[model samples]
Target chain A: MKKFLSALGGVILLASSSYAVNKENTGCGLGYMIFKEQEGLVYELLAVTTNGTFGNQTFGITFGTLECKKPEKIANRKLEIFVAENMDELAQDIARGNGIYLETLADLMNIPEEERPQFFSKLQKNFDKIFSSENVTSADIIDAIVSL
Target chain B: MVLLHFKDGKSLIDDPSFFLSPEGKKNPYKELQATIRAINRNPYLRCKFPARAFFIEKFLKINLPKVKCPELDKFLEEIKGEKISLIFADYYINSPASMFGHTFLRIYDREKNVYSFIVNYAAQVNDTNALIYAFKGLFGFYKGYYYISPYYQKIKEYVGIEGRDLWEYELKVDREMLLLLKLHLWELKDKYSHYYFFHKNCSSEILYLLGILKPNNSPHVRTPWVIPIDTIRAVLDKNLVRKINYYPSLLTQLRYLSKHLKDDDVEKVINWAFDKSELPKNGSAFLYEFAAQYVKFLYYSKDIDRRKYIKKYLYALKLRSKGGKINYSIKPEGYPHVSHRSQRFSITYGFNKVTQYMDVSYRPAYHDLLDPPQGYKKNGEIVFSEISLRFLPKLHRFTIQDWKILRIISLEPMYSFYRPISWKVDFGFHEFLNDRGEKRKFLSITSGFGFSIGEKITSFSLGEIKVMHNFDGEMPIAVGLRIGLLKQGKIFSFISSISSGKYLKEFNEKYFFDYSLRFAFHINRSLSVRFKTNYQLVGNKASFEPSVSALIYF
Candidate 1:
């Protein structure tokens, strides 16, 4: 029993190290999440007019910050950002059963090209299941896709 | 010297304090010596100005010094820039400042393509008042600074929100060149120059950054104004670009995806977006998809409220998910590099019923409605500082025909799914025939708002108000209606308009009718032949004029 427990702890250690690697490599990790949520009307307007941010505060994707702890969660975090950022187009692409955003999403999920058609069809057929409610967030849709 | 951006024997750096020596701003030799001495005294200056340090070591063939800059090292390591691309965001016509488009740099890491960062040099603008913004931008009132942000942020702002397409030109740059670029970007951090809208703008600054790598091949702004696309042409002319990629906007993608949908299907999609009807059960994925895109466009254009937009969009998506995948692709045309030159010069010889004349005209900037439509917004016109002179050969005298300071026309065609207002404004001085049928020069300001319909051949009707002041001390205000048909094509294009107005002149109301027709045959990208005619009936007098002209765009 002790040997089995030791083996389990070693597996956990290996998993955690992999998670740390994922955190470091995903260069634009948590900064996007933080910056996007706090973006106000004036900042957006400034971004539109000047193609530059207002004031001096740097926002969006800084050097190094790892808020995500687990490898799976880090992947989910990225998928969530992509979905949320491209929510409207992704929905249309899914409904139409094809689009660049859909292709990109398939790429993000590591869905091979041979499997993408089936996957897109599956999503289209189960659209109601994925987008179960009007208030469905990117996280919820991602969860639906995973479950499917 | 290239890194310092010395032009005409003077440094481009507007700030005096950036120079280490007293005369460093004006004298490159003094600046180079001072930079060397400063690096010798304090090795950290090499880190502060690594680009300059690289240049100094390379040119003088001597190693001055070395210093451990943990911060600089950390920055370089974190960026891991392996490649550089010049990104051009297509023009956003709604904003006066961005009408010419925008350009920036994308520094790409070897493996982290998604995490690539963009370096943008733009005027740090805080004022929302457009007139004030224009005044400041034109006269170098705003200070331009460089800011680095994630690539996705810009993609979201330009492509998703503003519906502006992006063209990526992967530059032929190596690792060493990338290092020089990063170092120069570091040097420019928190530094600023007085931003001039015309010459010392974003495109020019980006070109200066590129000049560090290929100093001799780098293009310079010879014209008084630096157009964004012209900068792209300059770079392309030197064969600096290796590959080109297009990222279409959401609207563009939608247009391409729905191109094959039937008329009834389009109507249904529109109906679904307005919540007037439910989507068909087990509808084709394309239908549902198009419906969702339509709703999203409405939301993005602010035609629909947020609450309605969200509800309708999600519903359509949910319905669309019940169908099979449909295949479609978006291939956009008319890239900026292929567009005709912005400045134009033309000389024409023509004859009316009265006499023959030679006309010489020059436009300093931008497209007119009759200009070649390639790489420009269709049915849209922005002409600035255009002047024409007429020489009557029989009379042997030159006269100012017209001097148009600014004229803007946006004729967006209306559809059942989309309805945008068409508007135009003209501020200019033109020679007009008075009631006595004699030429009288007048300064006129005319503005109109209306609706347009159709594609390829568009028809529009506008309610216009014209205020004119002639040299004879007569100021007349006219309320009129103008209708026109415009056909814009690659090889052939034409526009014919007729206007009728009631003018309040000398405490009396008089009706005036004016008609104009113009046809242009494009010989090539740069040359075109045009036939133009005008007829005017004021009070009981009428005059007609016809002319033929050849235009060369450069």
Candidate 2:
């Protein structure tokens, strides 16, 4: 319950602040806070994350938008962006219990091409839970994938 | 003269520090020969001999035999690094020598991995006493040298032990520039230079090193003092820095973890470490992970011994494996580059008990209690040349109020894991009321040691002692004991101290109390206002003075 409240608070804080500039920032957020961690806000995030490489280099190694982010995590990030960008198409696709975008995401997640039918059926059933509204964000998508 | 010219507009090397046979200014070739001869006589100078040799050949028209170090050559081959970067270790106020912070250079291998080698120029002193080191540093009594060590060694020292962050900037230099840099570094191999705390220190020396490659591009600070941040900015202004990275200190990382961790969960980990008999169950993965990292940090910082902590470290790891995978990555807040500059100038008009006066003040050096907190270490300040001038309108009296030579304050906060003592030292000249009720100049030294709670918005209680002396012995030395409270907030920082002491030689008891409040609300990044009021109790008489001032920064 405490975790739930903190997550709700974080959602409100992020929504209110300039941190809303980037939707890709996930992972820690309120989840880590409830888990005994403080996630840096987006504005404060860059300040704390990377150091004086000044402008040219980044920490560890760069993997697109995330540093040292693994391939599977990248797929999850892509899954979130794809769904948010095409919520209406995804809604229609899930209503029929199948879609091309879902198929592409599944491929990225390394789901077998043959299992697309059953996968879409399960996703379609969980669509409302996955994204309840226009306010539903990428973090919710990542949570759905890890839990699903 | 030629050697001096090559050294730059004005050489940082003081004459007494030089050991060459023929002085540098008299004859350039002879200076090169002496340097080469010294290099031949000593193996200690081997690492730096090559660059000096190349420099002499290029500028002085002297073709000296190339210095060789097969050992270093093979080591360089092993590293295979093509790029170099400048590193700045944040100020460690506990040690006065590092109050302005420290800067060094690093060589990155072709892999460009974080792990690299560090080249540092610092005074060679084995003194463990902070006071002695500070005294020597103030006088330029110690010799400075360049030494290379592994990057992790620096991290272990600065980050873990001293609790300071390290920021690194990669310079955009071509292969030719890189070669010139290497050659120039060798010139100073066995040479010693006077290390001035404000002017010729580590950061300034780094500027000289860069000047060797791109002399025109190095934006030299006109001031006598060169702070590390100024050097970083100078490099940026010259377009010398290509990239930047920040390596957070151990304390920062721990705080990052602690902010997210629950109080009980963190307590369990601490209890488990202290009470070795039993390991706590029902621990989450995040707690275990934090425990492991925290333990490792403790071990590296030498707060714990590996022999004793090994079992605990391994236990935390095992617990973490069971806690399952979790992402604990944290993003930081805003860039430090947005903070205000160091120098501050203020002008104010006010009415004292006697008359109305306008006061102007300038602080040339650094952080003071009333200064903004951004881009500066919390509770750390070094102030120099804090001069105040006052002009009375009714009496037509224009006099110097006070001139503070130097003041150093370290307010290291006490945390759950660490307890650092807070202390301060102040020395300067000020005008005080004499027995005749006239303003007189006197030299005073004030030193205090006490405990402080909170920072930025903190309330601190401290005991202090001060001594005042008049040169001609008209008034005997006065000593006093006092206590004070300081509560600093975003717009207002107030301090009040009351004390009672006697002039033993003068045969009198003098008491003092004053309250200072500064309001900084009407301000942006570059400007602010200080509305100050002071209530002072001298013997049986009390006086109240209020002042309003506008402060501007460039």
Worst 10 residues of 1 chain B by lDDT: B108-117
Model 1 docking tier (incorrect/acceptable/medium/high): incorrect
Cα-based lDDT at residue B378, candidate 1: 77
Model 1, runs deviating above 4 Å:
A1-72, A75-148, B68-70, B77-81, B109-115, B322-324, B351-355, B506-508
Error of 2 at B486 (Å): 5.8
Give the per-residue lDDT digits (tens) of candidate 2, residues B1-554. 21232444334555433435546545556766678677667744545445555555666666554456754454444333568777878877765567778888887743223344566777776664554566788788887766554454466467655678877788887776566666444344455677767777887777767776575565566667788778777777787877777787767777777767788777766766667435567766566656766765665545665444545554555454444335444443423444567788989999866788998989887777666666777767788888999998877887888888878876666666555667776777886654333456876666666667664455554555555666665444455655555554455555555555655444245544455555554366567777777665555566677988888765
**CA lDDT of A19 in candidate 2?**
11
Ten-residue segment with the worst summed lDDT in candidate 2 chain B? B1-10
Candidate 2 Cα deviation (angstroms), residue B477: 8.4
Best by lDDT: 1
Candidate 1 C-alpha lDDT tens digits along B439-491: 67777777788999998799999998767776567776678999999999999
Query: What DockQ number belongs to candidate 2?
Result: 0.01
